[model samples]
Target: MAFVLTSILGNDEAIKILSYKWIWSEEFLNKIPLYLLDDLLRHYNRSTMEEHKLLEILAIIKKDFQKSSENERFRD
Candidate 1:
């Protein structure tokens, strides 16, 4: 899974996979390590393409992570 996430940017099919809502779900996102997510964010930010879906996916992923962390903090 991490391999797919990390290499997705290199290929069209993989990049297309990012459009699916399941890819941004908490369960799938939680499966990915923070380091990898950070790396993905960096790559997404560095992208030269104008207003790509990857950016949108990144935003959704970040929002989900922020909400998840806030919920955890509230629980604590």
Candidate 2:
């Protein structure tokens, strides 16, 4: 999940969505690995050309996370 998020962050749309104050809160940010965060900072520091494609990927990830969260809630 962290890898996917970091990879998607390279896209401008993903960056814009993820950079929101609520979305980029410390709790969510802390879940990412340090190395992934460093790589994202160094490599994905700027937006990429494939913004639409990457945003699609981000949407898929978001859907998966929501499903997983729902499943977890049901289990609890």
Per-candidate Cα lDDT values, in order, are 0.51, 0.48
In the predicted model 2, the residue pairs found to clash are none
Model 2 earns a TM-score of 0.36
RMSD to the true structure for each prediction, in A, is: 12.7, 9.3
Clashing pairs in 1: none
TM per model?
A: 0.34, 0.36
Which tens-of-lDDT digit does each residue in 1-76 have in candidate 1?
3343455555664544444555656886775567655655566555632345445545655565444532232221
